[model samples]
Target: MKKNIFLVLMGILSVVSHVCAQSLPQETSQSIGIIEFVLKNSKYEDTKCDIHSCQMKSKDGGVSLTLTHATMKQDKEEDLHYLLKINVQGTLFSTKVEVRYRNDPSKQTMKTGKRSDEVDSSYKTEHRVLRSWIQFIKDSTTSKS
Candidate 1:
């Protein structure tokens, strides 16, 4: 039936994606930290920065990201963002992770009658470009050393 064929195609696609992901692409760093990723990959529009978040407009379709939060921590060399420190196995690894941002609070995209917490992660949009940068650095460094 049609359902059987669809399932087979899904299975093959999943396998292909998995195999492709094993060898992650490498990312080059500008200043050895998340500062570069944040500044470069974020919207090219003027960013109105605040204590905890920065407002930016995505160049793709001019979508605005308000109160944006990111996954990467600011490196000591940079004064633009915060640094995320993690203790793993009693050792510390300062990682350059990508960021996630909450949509403009004024705009509601979820279903009605559901509270923000009840829906899911408030940070809805993923900065794919920035994320790729983080992944590239992590893979290149960790895999070698």
Candidate 2:
């Protein structure tokens, strides 16, 4: 009975906590600007992008947005409750994220695997903000002939 009760409480807590995280629109202009900046400044090898977009996959058949700073804010939302501040070492910058329990203030769960670089190896949860930027670049670019 004790074990069952403990598990039930933990489950309820998890749900409650998750319900509090926050998420913004996936295609916001602010997101696009950040993605463009990272892609242009990262020097990630053969990446071609302006302040507006990035190119398709490289000839090497791989894409990596290595961050060069430590925890840059990708969104302008003031109520950063569980904002996930991530810092990578390669694509663009290297930095840490300001996340609580691996969720944004509104607990936006990142389901995509496009830009999930963890600066620290001990982390298990991936940041979706980064991935969203990466996807934006890919989606905006025109295919080469």
Candidate 3:
């Protein structure tokens, strides 16, 4: 009798688990094609953009966008270059965005900093701002299309 009851309970548990799994909402996935199309049609104010391939398979063939901003120093007419790269990957049913920020100033201007080469430094607040900005760009571009 105990053996029969144990088998019955196991059967019920399996059925319930299957039902729950099927009822759970699945994440909406976007295709790489759509992502590429949206990126091509997107535009940013006061920024120059360069789009290229990142070649990450898991991210459904990654796409990279380098947004460069040049600001002129107040005292000197030197240009300070800031580059923020947004790496986008589309998986089977999800999209991922990674942001990389860097400061690329002229050798003369960069002398004031610790390193002469491009500096890769960003704060949490900056990341939040960039994430929102990227979201805006994505939304605006999709809406226009």
Per-prediction TM-score to the true structure, in the order listed: 0.22, 0.21, 0.21
Q: lDDT per prediction?
A: 0.35, 0.38, 0.38
lDDT of 2 by residue, 1-145 (tens): 9999999999999987775533234433244345446545543334455543334333333334322221225333332223323333345434332222232322333222243322222111223444454444455443321
List where candidate 2 sits over 4 angstroms from the true fold: 1-44, 56-59, 64-124, 128-145
> Highest lDDT, which number?
2
Q: Write the per-residue lDDT of candidate 3 for residues 1-145, one digit (tens) a residue.
A: 9999999999999999986654311211122234445455544333322342111121223444543444445223434333334455445333443332333321111111132222122323223344444455545434544
lDDT ranking, best first: 2, 3, 1
Positional deviation of residue 66's Cα in model 2 after best superposition, in angstroms: 13
Worst 10 residues of 2 by lDDT: 117-126
The superposed Cα distance between candidate 3 and the true structure at residue 105, in angstroms, equals 24
Error of 2 at 64 (Å): 7.4
Residue 15 lDDT in candidate 2: 85
Better of 1 and 2 by lDDT: 2
lDDT of 2: 0.38
